[model samples]
Target: MEVKKNPNIAVSRNSSLYFAIGLNVMLLITWLSLEYKTFDKPDVLLENLTLIEEFEEDIPITDLNMPPPPPPPPVLSAPETITIVEDAKEIEETVIESSETSQDEKIEERIVEVSDVDVEDIDEEVSVPFSVVEEVPVFPGCDGNSNDELKACFSKKINDHIIKNFRYPQAALELGIYGKVFVLFTIDKDGNVANIKSRGPDKMLEKEAERIIGLLPQMKPGYQRGRPVSVPYSIPINFQIQN
Candidate 1:
């Protein structure tokens, strides 16, 4: 059999309400005690307040008698003297030569004799594109080749030349400078490499690339329409320092 416990001995739900009421009562009592203990504030005196202005002493005016500044000096004008000359010679009129003279007249004839020039001796500058050339240049060791084969052989020979003469500059190698140097050179009508220009990361590398390109052996000149023409070629030389 289960025995039921007494509910009054346990905490009731309305106990919180009693605690709240007790807290409110304590606060009310503290406020009442504070109000009753406070004395009446002293009565504010209603005396009439008048603004008293400070007396400013009268200052005496001083009369300063200063002499007037002296007048500026007068400017003197220079005298204009009119001197008349007794005798003056009149200028004579000059006579100009007339340009309407006859052809038979004895006038000085300036002869500007120009000699006949022979333009045939002057070689006309001609440039032909290497890609569309009638006959491509042949490398020194690449003779006995057709046009297309000659182009391929020439490219191979140029690369081989660069490789054979490639030298990294000491300063560049020490500084770990490595880059591709574009070498532009012109193959003249005489088959000699000329007008070499190179651009690279450093001056030393550019100079080295220029030197290699300048060492290219003379080849047979490319011809277009039965006349030799200059051919511009560009090649890139890579300068790398092997670790």
Candidate 2:
């Protein structure tokens, strides 16, 4: 057989066919590589992620049924400063004065308390004479009926009587008692003695002096500015037991 030659045409057809097949084969390999790589991707995470952790410590927890401990007591603080105080002392003295007249009166006035069992009844009685009061000076005897005259006469009469009968109390003499006894009396316009009151160391002495003064005779009446008037008077009786 004799060969007919189209060498360039055959070469063109075979080159085109070979080039298309190579391109398709290359595209298929790239797709298969991409799928396998995506399917086998590595699991990864970024750094600085805030991680949370849960733990169970061995510390014991109180039971709901158990009682709790008591709270602590409050504390007391010391004072910043202390103060001290001192008391002042005082001195005193007392003095007392006693009256001899008051002592005598108290001694005579005090009542003696005797037991009834120790007391005895007596049937006998004793009668004693009235105490003798010396006569007092006679007043004016209404000679000068003036009130001043009467007052002067009455005062003189009473004073004289008091002087004559004045005696020292035996107890007072023994106890060395000495004092002035006060006497009060009132004179009337008729020169007569009105009210007479006497206080002395002894009641017996006081009464005896009063009785003698009462016995004085009528005197010239007392006078106020030359007119008859009544007046009150006070006198002191001084007795001396020492001779």
TM-scores for all candidates: the values are 0.52, 0.32
- The true-versus-predicted C-alpha distance at residue 73 of model 1, in Å, is 45
Q: Could you give candidate 2's per-residue lDDT for residues 163-198 as a string of tens digits? A: 676655676678776655676665566657668888
**What are the clashing pairs of model 1?**
none
Clashes of 1: 0
Decoy 2 TM-score against native: 0.32
| Off by more than 4 A, model 2 | 1-138, 141-159, 167-177, 225-227
Q: Whose lDDT is greatest here?
A: 1
Candidate 2 local Cα displacement, residue 105, angstroms: 88
Measured with C-alpha atoms, the lDDT of residue 28 in candidate 1 is 100
